[model samples]
Target: MNKISYIRWFNEIGIDDVPLVGGKNASLGEMYQNLTAEGVRVPNGFAVTAEAYCSVLEYNNAWQSLHAALDGLDPDNIRDLQARGEKARAIVYGCQLPDDLQVEILQGYAQLKREYGETISLAVRSSATAEDSPEASFAGQNDTYLNIASDDALLDGYKRCLASNFTDRSIHYKYDNHFDYYKVYISVVVMKMVRSDIGASGVMFSLDTETGFKDVVFINAAHGLGENVVQGTIDPDSFYAHKPSFVMGYRAVLKRRLGSKEKKMIFTNTLNTGNIAVEYTKNIDTSSEERSHYCITDSDVMVLTDYAIKVENHYSNKAGSYKPMDMEWAKDGLDGQLYMVQARPETVSSQKKGNILEIYHLKERSVVLLRGRAVGTKIGAGKARIINDVKHLKDFQPGEVLVADTTTPDWEPVMKIAAAIVTSRGGRTCHAAIVSRELGIPAIVGTENTNEVIKNGQAITISCAEGETGTVYDGLLGFEIQQTDLSQLGHPKTKIMMNLGNPDQAFSFASLPLDGIGLARMEFIINPTPRESPRFSHGEESGKLVLT
Candidate 1:
């Protein structure tokens, strides 16, 4: 594959191949090819091609230079690590652009111009081989230079991108992923950009974060480029859209502010709508307000929705082909276009019948507590010990009981290696319970104070199959699968689920035929650190209080 020509790489792999395609190219291919097939209007753009990147790195013998700079620095020493990363980047930027790769890039840009129009402003971005992952979003890890003014800027932007591999965040991620210094590669894509008078954009997910319900489409739309939404920097307009109904069930925000064309950066005279002509602005940092505008109209929204569904379906189909996917997507509001940004293996277990065999009788409602949530069901038995970070998670030896405030996505890897799972926040619909049940392990959620009551590495027993009343034995008491039909659980129509913090939770719930989730909290979705909630937030915040 390394020896293959750049053009061939673009032809065969395309954007669908996330691992090898590189993120920017994959998104372009997804939007321009697949999503367009379903009739969505994506902003026009062309990928500079990953092969071009490889050719540049290989031809320049740049790997050795970069390697020499970052060769033996301790990955954990963030300060020294950053300084070395900067040094490597300086070397990459200092090198001259190769003639042939430059020519190819220019040709792609020229082709885009012929198609989208010569004056089209473009968004030049870095799509490295190692970025945009299930475990890592690669948020701002690479450079995405928006609103390029001329051809010269585009070329420079590409160089800037190559240099960005050395950015602090990118360096840290590479270290965390254990990517080899010499092996890490990057791709550049110079896309025909969307120029909007009113900039509005944001991210949307197929599942609800507050609840694990798979039926709802959770959206966070803001006035600007959607950066605020991804970074959790702004209180964007939040909505819950029901999938089956395709209707907005709920929407909330403190305020709504759109971007304006009056700013000096206005590059286009086109107006998307009379009412939405202004771009939205939100206070991102203390300095000047961050601005964004939405160009997708109501009709465009419908078109984008259809496109989003197709992109999602494509991902689902791929995952189904191998094993179905749990996915994420974002849209370019400027063009009423949707982009398939991420996809991952679905791990939540199938739900089981509320059979007698699935049920376990509990000794009493003697449970530990942790961080709390608004709602959820309880399972398991023990004095819950709240774990905070990867260090704390690693501290657990085999057979030592574990508990948390709430689970998050990052916690997935560690959960696979834990003795037991307990939380104070999630309900039957939560990620923790779902994954636990799938793993066929004991998990108790909504067990408030599991953190306060249990000490680190304390011995305990747990049972999710246990009835509403369960006993907490200081020693290992039992392991059981308490099951119940959703119909009998009060909401016969809705799927009952527990919230989860990590990917392992999903796998743990793999055996049950759960109608999917009613909620999957993205927060508490990762492994907890020592400082946060003591890993018992669910217990203290949402679980029942038991006085022995």
Candidate 2:
């Protein structure tokens, strides 16, 4: 058989091919290769390689033009940067796909049709080289076309994905991350669409996103397309499953939150102004009946939680270490089957030092100004800065609490500088909550009227240390931070094991007078350190020293 250049099937690739297929495709291929036989459902797909993307630009004579447009451009000058980015994208859009690449894509699609059927609708998604990495997640920074049914539309989607590499946000992200524009390349992932329009779709994390708690699987689900949940356009239903207890056949669903999912994105067939047939997503108002019901059932929740645990365990065993994953899942209402669309390494708390638990307590009683789902186990107090738009993000001073109606990826620049975040709309998996947790800042989301109730420049206390309900208090209420030493603690008859996840805290934890560490999350200690390697078999006793 001759070597194929343009496309690589999901079964033919793995995580090692990230340079060729990009992170998203690489992860999909990884799951398909390693977990499909284990009963995990991943939609069949093929990736247009980075080499194909480069060839397309070279064939269209746009490579030189794009580089020249980017030459000496000041990324800090927003207008100039946007203008250059637009010019580059225009060049990509103006060009046509090389005949060979087009033939390859069509051939790949035909193979899928042979397997799935002739009327199989596809999703074309952009997968940049640096996206979905453990260091930085460029989520929702590119384009994705769903329900593409024709050859022309598929080709067009490919071009759009290529052009999306020059989106203003993409350009700014590259500049902000110090990634060389020339080195970053784009790959297109063409996969069988999971018919999420007919059912439900959302995101799931193997570990608790809020507090870096390793014993739970956090899932967020909403009707129709999963983008709404990821983009923070709608609040979704939240589910938390206790992982430790789950293994013992206990359905430990710790909590469930029903969101006001007022809108849904459904795929529809329509004709363009030019009379061309196209498949697009239409935003329809969700009925009161739909809003009041859960998108998924209790059975589905258990299945999803089980899959999360299985995926984590599979990857952990493969890498000879623990691996917490961020995954996207969808249900096919037509067939009542669920599918895993994408999975990647969890970037946030997994990378942080988790030795110390900073417990916060309010020193004085105060009136609660607002309440919502808490995203951390700490307290923050600062002047509240109510920001309604991204244009005035710079006006927000550092150490001020960021109060917003909602937040998108654009608000990240100012969100990092905030001492805390309070949002009027969003769930635990929304952008505001996710970023706040990653930044180690306290956040209270889904307050519904936080922006209206909270005034600008008012001193307020944001407390997420109190269970699931986060509260915003009026004035600068006094608080105390108590750092408990892991080494020195009172002993009891029963074993008191420490939850030592970060390797940096291993030595300190080892000095503790407890029986032993209960869950030393392997991903945290995977990186090489000066000390000996830590190794433990499954189901080990508490007193046994696991660290080598």
Candidate 3:
């Protein structure tokens, strides 16, 4: 366990080793060490330690140059930020791995080959120190290389993983979250490839993502790799399994939705004219049968649900509380065995208290202009702003409904300013739905043609108050907010709390009989005030605070 020795096998680490191997790899190691005996299958792998990442920077003298490039750089200046990040990444990518680090990585790869096969394809993924934490999720911000077969490609993938820390989205995320760019290190995780490209792969959440319901497991499956589902490039099959029913021997699958999965991503080998072979992901059309039918059978769905429950229970037992997990699973076409590729603490819903429910109702029934999956339980009215590209986001005004085909993390700047969002693509876990929920805005995703149906500057009403179905009306609509105060009855067993973001609303809500605020967003208070240095009166020391 020498600090300088920079490689660690999955079995040698656990959740406590996050500082060493990063969150994703640490979680993998935890599962490998603790859950393997429970029949939970995880691909064996090794993580290139955070110290190894530092060695690369230290060996190439990149720390000072990277810091200099980032110092005083304005995150708002997109061009400048891009140039600086590209330069920093180039420095890391151009440098060679230290001899010892290289040797260790090669040795680790050889060990994996010994366990699996000599020509075993691998997946090299970036695991940032701050990624997949409960406070924030940097899941899609980093890079992952799949279907790497050769030693050269594995080394290249490792370099690419290290360089991905400077991706535009990653840079912006770190800056916005006030994370130190210098202190955050990247660890590379190299695991046995699951061969999911020849079968089906997808993501699963132990709890319902949209409604914050903990009684069910939500899964999204698609043909070939799981990237198609994660990227929202294709609408995948969705299934829900009721935990209570399953535990009671009912094995009830509450619902299933067949998505129009038109495309699949598979790895392919291509030979150039010079006879040099290259491996990369290739997009292909899915058959009509494939698009129409569910990717996995009912039995497979039940097995996945059971696995989800087992994982949740294991983590809960370890943490001494209910631990909702977000997991990725793939079905190997060759052996037909399911494998858990990744797992992290569920970021949303799990953090929220479920004691009180706020309901909104429309007094008068208006014609529903469009309907889609609801993202929040609220009603909002605003002018429609159809924007198909990010460049046109500047034209969007506050209190306007944003209409788009889909959204990525890069569109977050404008998304924050939107009153409500309507998208033609994406499911509950998509970027638009996730961000909208975080912003506490009403959103309707998978509207199919919201961008084409809604005209710019047209008044629209977004109603997500109803169950599951989100409706967009053509005109401004009246709505009533109803509060079912559970606190007024006999002394409540659980605490009832409110989320206070705006200081203006705090005084009004303070009069309500309830527990103290559960959350007081500090940004809302500080962002509006003028910036100033700390000041103290003559009687008070600099470190001491005096209240008026």
Candidate 4:
């Protein structure tokens, strides 16, 4: 218990420990404490308390300097923001951990090493906490250091995480969210690393990412670490599992789409390798055979789906309402097992009331040029502007469709002006998809060949209205929009069988008068080709017809 001052094991803490350990660690702790008994695998870890962060800053007498550096900040001024952020971070990075804290940290590391092995690698994550701001609300507030193997490496990574609290992106996140800089404290969580580099990893959501549908669990998977999918570096293999059907012992995997997992991230043996600035991990190209094969099996997806549903239900019980979950999972190559790395309440879709229904109909169907994960529920048409690098961000015109390999929060300024976004990488939970959803801009993400196939300055239409898989049409075809207040609508009873094909229309039709679906032809509702759907794209049987 003497180590309580510096380290709190994940199993010992819960969601209520957010103030002390921060949301990320507290969530991991919550799952480890509650869900492991139910067979939801959470890797063991410990959190370096937020109090430790304050103690380190106070011990070095750097708090005043750090606060002063961020006094007159201008979030709009790019150069000024960068300078101040770097300066504030430098103050924290310059400070040393107190002797007692260092000893406590080493002790925690030693315990983990003893459990895993002498060469155990840990993922050092920075969890920022404050009174009003939930961790999910402010996306990417700090850096995560993965694959740390040594004592010095762990300590160094911890300090870097502390410093990341003042990163320019973190500053932007804080400024946007109106969080008091000093009030937020950063806790470093040193957790056991999953050997995903040798296997596969990806992200999961208890509900559909697009349209805020709650009947299905959406999963995006890829070879190597989950970062590739989260960062939109890879078009991860997509799967939709029907939660209701799964419970009834049916083939719950309603649909599956194999992704062109072009690259996989793996642990690097050497510290520094040429131009690559990353220390622990490196990205390498995947074989065509590897890309072609689905990394996870059907049984794997079902198990993951079952666990995801458990997480959502557990959280919903705690909140006294429905609470969807956004979780990260990894497959350990050595153990051949799946582990939930992290879990947080899905901030976006869960909050939506689905009160307003916008029904989009394409009057003319053109050649389907490209497809990816859909972000928004609407449609957008504009000229395609392919930007390869950040330097060319200035040249982008307003209302242009942003076609890129991927996007970060840094590209928000440009992304806002885009009529729609099309990325060659990333899944529905990625930065590009998340930002576009918040901004109300339609986006097609994880379209593997968008950068190559989509011509620059070409007129195109991006439509997420179809379903889960967004499509980029060859031309700006005519489309109609009908908005209805679903809250005021009444479902009149009648023995009428609805003829449905497109999954997008199913939601709008649900508000209408109808008896139970009479004949929902499996062939009609199911889009055999993966390109046809997003949230409801591969919906099988009557899963697509059921609302809520």
Which candidate's TM-score is highest? 4
In order, candidate lDDTs are 0.51, 0.83, 0.81, 0.82
Summed over model 3, clashes come to 0
Model 4 regions lying over 4 Å from their true place: 1-4, 130-135, 273-278, 362-369, 382-385, 392-400, 451-460, 473-480, 495-497, 503-548
Would you list the clashing residue pairs of candidate 4? Answer: 232-426, 467-534, 468-533, 468-534, 468-535, 469-533, 469-534, 533-537
The most accurate candidate by lDDT is: 2
Model 1, 343-410: lDDT tens digits are 33334321222332233444444343333221112334444456765445544444445577666433
Superposed model 2: Cα runs more than 4 Å off: 1-4, 71-81, 270-272, 275-279, 389-399, 478-480, 485-548
Instruction: Write one digit per residue (lDDT tens) for candidate 4, span 1-548.
Output: 55547889997898998899988888899999999999999888999999999988999998889879998888756677778988998999989888898898889989998898887888998887752122345556588888888777788889998998888777876776678788889988899999999999998888776766677898989999878887888778989898989888886997788888899998885765442234678899999899889999999999999889899899889989888888889999989999998888877766666687777878888889998778877889999999888667767888999999899766766786799999988878788987787677899887888877889989999888887678999988788998888778676654676876655445335545555333254544444344433344343653354321
Q: Which residue pairs collide, candidate 3?
A: none
Give the CA lDDT, 0 to 100, for residue 3 in model 4: 51
In TM-score terms, candidate 3 sits at 0.84
Alpha carbon deviation, residue 429, candidate 1 (Å): 20
Candidate 1 structure lDDT? 0.51
lDDT ranking from best candidate downward: 2, 4, 3, 1
Predicted candidate 3, C-alpha RMSD: 15.4
TM-score-wise, the better of 2 and 4 is 4
